[model samples]
Target: MSAEHHPRDRRTARVGLVLFLLTAVLYVATAGYQRVHIDVLSADVGAWRIAATGEPSIDGLDTSSINRSRVDLFSTVHDGRTVIARSPGVVAAGVPAYALRQWVTDAGPDAEDFTTVPPTVTAALLTALSVLLMWGALLRLTTRRRATAAALVFALATPVWSVAADGMWTHTLTVLGVSGMAFGAARDRWLLVGLFGGIAVWGRPHMALVAAALALTCAWVRRRPGIVARVAAVGATLTAGASLWSYWLYGRWSPSGGYAPAPYLSRGAGAQYEFNQTLGGLLRNEAAMWLSLDRGILVWTPVVVVLLPLLVQTWRSQPAWTRALFLAGVGYTLFQGAVAPFHGGDGIYGYRHGLEFLACATPALVVATARVGRRTRVVLTVVIGVQLAAFSLGGVLNRPTLSFRHHWNDNAFVSGLRDVPLLWAWVAISVALVLLLSRMFLREGAREA
Candidate 1:
């Protein structure tokens, strides 16, 4: 049946719109409260703004007015001139906002103390829209309420909240693209699936794994012939365009020209040499990524720990495409941990490198947990409460930086929550509310059953 004829699809889109608006408002309010501007967290936004002003290289641009440390984020071109080393897709994405900021300020995009509000808020809106798309995808396989719940968890309990709301980081755009790809795939919108997938790859080369997985799933698992051709066409076109731009900027067709020392060498010979000692070292890093309290995945969002079991339980019942998407998330996470130079994503909170997987696989997780027993659902709710508490408190208290060691200790839980009595009170309230909601939902589900 067509999506237009499905009542669930209509409801899902409506709920998605509400969630999107709520997310946008929350992000904008937070940005305002924080008095956000182009800071280190959004150095790329600043770089893009400069690029929008027609300056290809920031080599001689006076950055003294801005945070000098942000300049370090850019890459030195082959000619020894400093340039934004990251992909231009993000810069291109922010052009509309940059233009708006210029008009608002009535000054050059390079004006000192120029506000980053436009681009930052634009990024947040994009993220909210992505979350909406993810919710719509979840709705295809689960109840509307369950899909709404998943969207809430994604927007509130995950790093998606902190990271996307902060600025136009590459991950922010990548999440939007990935979520759109998943939504399109769920609805058999092959063209949109390929389009968003290609956009994601353009935003972050590593996301090619996700794009390829989606394309292959449609072609092999779903047996959709046209999907492969569409994906390849879009992917090839974007990659070729990006390559040409890279050649112009770096004199080589390298997309990662900005990440100096190259990804492989960035971690230095000690780590690379030790990792080559055996595959064990790579596995150890992956384990550490999930188990290390300092920056571990579960340590930051314990709800995911609960979701894992639920996901495994519902594996057999899931659609082949959903299963493929879940594997894609796992593959991307493993790939990032094993190969990426910055395993933890350096400056963000809570395994930012894994945000794409976490956000993209959320629909699969919601579907997996939809039929879980009441007790299990209650437990999941509590875990989500704790995750929300941690994310909320940490976002407010922790210093936003590349390294957390300075502000967080070996035990992030203790360090983050120890001294904040008000935050503890908030956590108590949040848990109680979660339990009440869980009971209501379980009762409602029982009545329907």
Candidate 2:
């Protein structure tokens, strides 16, 4: 912000832009519908339909292009006619891409399929921007050199690539929101934190607690009630707006809308959902989220291992708002893990539920990046090397069908390696490359220090 940092900051911005383009291309290229086409496909249909017609329901259109089931259970609900059910944010977010796809393809208003690049590109671009914002967040608490290293790991080696970038899932929007929170909270920009906090809820309704955590923690830590009040005002406006949108689309005040199987909570819909948390389910699921190879956050993102040793020190080192942000991530993870379907569905490579925790930990991780030893760097590189090879084989280059067709207990990365000979080669080459890069990073960090 000062004159002393202007040149370097601009350089960092340029570097981030380059990374943005590179990441976007990879994300879009590797994206495939697999079993999740309807997720974003419905969004495109909804946005396009809204543009051409006033009606929200796709009653007359042929929806076979997206392979939408004639009577799918969760994705849609029947009132009088079938609706292409999706979260309000998901539908709204894809409007620009749907428009662009239509313009470039010269498609008519009647067209239902949006393709060439899947409409999920909206999620991809947003996730890429989060990487740049992550770099900025790191710079707030650490040197540029450390910030770049951590941001690169975030982009390439984390679930931002394997899970969020795979499709237009909630993880895409949720990561973006939390990344904004990290950027704002690190600098005590209460309003920015609050604004993104509200947006995070739109990404996933359960994430309402995230904004609540940030607001209350900021109030408690900074003890600036007036500024925190501004945070609440901005966040409340967005929250109210999203609720209105939900009601208009879903015809109910409930955030879950018509997604539930039952008509209402009074009629046994509560049985389908678990408000009464099982102690065993909570303990088992939460532990598995961090420790299990099948869908553990650490397994997919071993780079976070470095943060473990530094959490306490960095917790002491960071400001109150930052610490509060990380604690909020902890609470978010626990609550989500408690209520989510066991071990998450058997569709993805890593644990999508753990993303916010990783995002919120950025400040502590950035502070800790400076302290990691060279041996630890190479060792972490080795862990990441195997992870990249596994993810590329299982997640990007192909879908995680082994888990889907068989069971969630199966590790998609391991299955990818076992079934594909090419992945063995990928592991051989990538491990060497990451090791070489680790040495270069070590030298650069030493010179900068």
Best-performing candidate as measured by lDDT = 2
- CA deviation > 4 Å runs, candidate 2: 1-5, 33-38, 68-79, 102-106, 109-118, 255-270, 273-278, 404-408
- What TM-score would each prediction reach against the true structure? 0.86, 0.87
| Candidate lDDT (C-alpha), each | 0.67, 0.68
- lDDT per residue, candidate 1, 91-156, as tens digits? 556667766656666556453645556667777788888888888788688767777777888887
- List candidate 1 segments past 4 Å from native: 1-13, 32-52, 68-71, 78-80, 109-113, 260-281, 341-347, 395-413, 446-449
Q: Which candidate leads the pack in TM-score?
A: 2
Predicted structure 2: lDDT: 0.68
Residues 143-168 of candidate 2: C-alpha lDDT, one tens digit per residue:
66768777877877777787777766
Minimum summed lDDT over a 10-residue window in model 1 is located at: 32-41
